[model samples]
Structure formats: structure tokens, C-alpha cells
Target: MAYPDNLLSRGESVVLSKRPHWKMLVLPIIFFIVIVGGGFTLAAVLRNWEYHTIAWIVIGVLGLLLLIWLVVVPFLRWRTEHFVITNYHVFFRSGILHRREHQIPLGHIQNMETSVSFWGRLLGFGTLIVESAADQPLEFENVASLPKVQSVLNQLIMDDKQAHRGGPQQGGYPTGPTPAQG
Candidate 1:
């Protein structure tokens, strides 16, 4: 999806962009299954005729909390987190109540590497490690559409390099003395 042009400065263009891989939803799915299974197990275990009311209430409350986490938490995370890339930088934003954002400039980027697990490969997703000349490496973990993101980043880097190499426009402009005069 295209972000507003006003979001970045002049000469900036989006290079690589993606969301978290669908695989990330797995944990929440497992949590949901566990909650259901546990609820059933609790029901069976508490089938005794003399069960305490307090114990039953506690089990119900725990199950409700689990249900909220499984159903609501994952959905909120999926909706809130976003990974964005521009010609000059990469941006990561996430969180619901307390928002967080991080930006890494392309000029500082030393190299980028991608890793994919068997399941991730099957699903066409991977993790991207962005190394910088400075301390601390930035990681884009479990990112979907990795190959396309990589390709765009590579192309942007090449373009930036070529632009740098072309060197001092308008035919040098003879700063000291002309060769013809010498």
C-alpha cells in the first residue's frame, strides 16, 4: 500500500515494504487451542459434586483472560505493526497503547541478509537482518514478501552508489587552470 508522499522528504521513495509473516499468527492460534482444551479439561476435572464455588469462579476468570489474549491480542498486533522502507531509510512502527517507531538510514546500512526456515520458505516469507556501520543490528523478523523487499533494497543501493560515482556535474568547471593554458 502507498503511504502519503508527505510522509517523507524530497528525493525519498519507498524501497522495501512488508508486514509480519502469516506464520506469526501461529502462536496465538496455539494459545487459542490450549485455552479451549484446558477449559474442557478443567470442566472434566471439576465434575465432582462437592466442588468449591470459588475454584469454579477462578477457572472461569482464567479462561476469559486466555480467550481475550488469544482472540484480541494477536489481532491488535497484526493491525498495529508496520514495516516501511524508503530510499533514504527503513521505518518500523508497532504497538497499540504506547506506540513505538524506529528509523535506520540507508547511508548507514553496511549489508543486509535474509533467512528463511523450511516452513517460511514454503510460505514465501523470511527474516531480514540489516547491519549498520554503527552499533546494534536491526532485524526485520518474520517478514512476508521478502524476495521482493530484498530486490527493491538492492536496486536502491545500486542506484545510490551509481549516483555517488558519477561525480561533480557540469564538466569539472576548471577550478585552478585550464589544460590548454598550461
Candidate 2:
């Protein structure tokens, strides 16, 4: 889904937006299949029992609880999580009930690094480490299209730096004459 436009500043525009990689849901989906299949198999086995109706109810409740706690919660969290890069800032927000958000202005970014294993490269997903002017670096894990994301952020940071300086500055001085010189 598109990042909500209202979150951006007046002139800011989104460059990239993504949720965590689909790999993050693999375990949860496996759990769902196992729990659901096991639940159905157990219910079928108990069909001939004298207390079959109560047994079915008990199985259903347990299955539902397992589904909600394991499968449903992770899916909700995945859907709610957002990593957005704009021309001006990088925004990360995630949570279902209680939200956590972090915004780093593009100009504040000092360095960036990406880590990808063989499987991650094959899957087109990896972790991005963003070191801003802040003391500690922030790691964004399971980022989809990690290389593209990193490249876009690099470009945006460069552009932001140039814009703040009123175009690219060379050496240790401004590009043009100073006010006194002018």
C-alpha cells in the first residue's frame, strides 16, 4: 500500500515505501497450516466420541487461540509496519496497538551500510544500517529490495545536502562570492 501522503511535509515526496520482507511471515504461515490441519484432524478423530460436540468446541477454541496469538498477530504487525523514504527524511513506523516511530532527516544521515547473506541476496531482502548524526546507528531488518532502498537513500541524502548548501559546495568555502565580496 502507498504511504499516507498526510505524513509528509508540504514539499516532501516519497521516494520508496516498503514493509518488512515476505520472508518474515514464513514461520507464521507454517504455524497456521500446522495448527489448522492438526485441529481438523483431531476434530475428525473425535467425531465418534460420546462427548463429540464438547470436544469439537474445545478444539475449536484452542485452535482459534493459537491462530490469533501466532498467525494473526504477526500478520497484523507486518501489515502495520511501514518504512518510508522521502526526499527530506527517512521514516520508520511499526506496531499494532502501541506505535513506535523514528524519523531521520536526510541531511542528518552520516553513513549507511547493508548486510545480505547468500539467501538474502537470492530473496532480494536484507538489513540496512543507517547511521545518522545521532549517537547510535539504527538497523532496519528484513528490508525488501535492500540495495535499491540503500541507493535511493544515498541519492536523497546527497540531494538534501546540496539543497541545504544552495547547490554543491566545493573545497571548504561557498560556491560563489560572499556578501562582503558581492
Candidate 3:
């Protein structure tokens, strides 16, 4: 999904935008398959028994509830979750029903790290932990292409610092008149 540019400062732009890794969909996909398969299996078994009408009704209701919780909810949660890194801020927004958004400015960031477990290394995705001065650390979990994200964030932080300093701009252009003539 495209980010709203109105929220950004004039010169600022998104450096990286991503959703959680496909690994996150593993459990939801499994649950979806199980729910569908179980529904079919229950229907077949009910057909074998002539007096299963009432029992089938009860099972169907329970199955639907389980499907909503295990399959549908997880899918929606996964779809809504987002992690974004812009020149000025790191944004994390997530939730299925009531959403929550957290932002950490690059200037406020005290420390950052990239982490990967054995399984995460195997999957080629990792997490980014960002700690700022005023607030608690924010974890961007299950980030796809984590190394690239880390590199881009570092570059953005440097560029942001340079932008605020106004000493030199891109392509080695000075913000003020050079003293070479004087």
C-alpha cells in the first residue's frame, strides 16, 4: 500500500516500506487449511449418520467460530500490519480491529540493531530493534530483507543529520558561498 505523502516533511520520503515476512503467514495458512479440511470431513461424516442433523448444526456453529478466530482474524491482522522507514521517522502500525501506530524519529534514535535467529536466518528475514531517547524501544518484527532495511536506515539517518546541518548537500554542493574567492 502507498503511504500518505501528506504526513511527510517536504524533503522527506520513504526509504523502506514492508509488511511482515511470509513466514508469518505460515500458521494462518495452516489454520485455514485445517478449518476447510475439517469442515469437509465433518460434512462427510454427518452424511454417514442419519440422526446427525442437530449434532451437525452445533458442530457447524463451533467450526465457524473457530474459523473466524484462527483463520480469518490472523489473516486480517497480518494484512494490516506495516513497518515503514522514512527519512525522518520509523513508523509501525498494526491491529485488526483497533489500530495502533508508533513513530520514532531518526534524530531521536539512540541505538539500533538487526537480529536473526536460526529459523530467521534460514528464512532470510529478521527483526529491527530501535531505541529512542524519550520512548521505549520499538521492534519492527519479522521484517523482510532486514539487512537491506538496516543499511537504508543507517544511510537515511546520516542524510537526515546532514540535511539539518546544512554544511554540504548532495553532490558536494555547499549551502553558502565558498570562501575560495575571498
Top-TM-score candidate index: 2
lDDT of 2 by residue, 100-140 (tens): 99999998899898999899999999999989897589999
**Colliding residue pairs in candidate 2:** none
In order of TM-score, best first, we have 2, 3, 1
**lDDT tens per residue, model 3, 17-108:** 88899988889789878877887798788876877887778778988899899878887887899888997899988987798999888888
- What is the model-wide C-alpha lDDT for candidate 3? 0.84
Candidate 3 Cα misplacement greater than 4 A, ranges: 169-182
lDDT of 1: 0.77
Ranking by lDDT: 2, 3, 1
Misplaced by over 4 Å in model 2 are 169-182
What would the per-residue lDDT of candidate 1 be over residues 1-182, giving only the tens digit for each residue? 34446778898877655668877787888888888788878877887838646667778889889888786788778767888889887788778788887787766778999999998889988888988888487788888888988888787766666556563343354455678877
The TM-score values for the models, in the order shown, are 0.70, 0.90, 0.86
lDDT of 3 at 77: 81
Give each model's whole-structure lDDT: 0.77, 0.91, 0.84
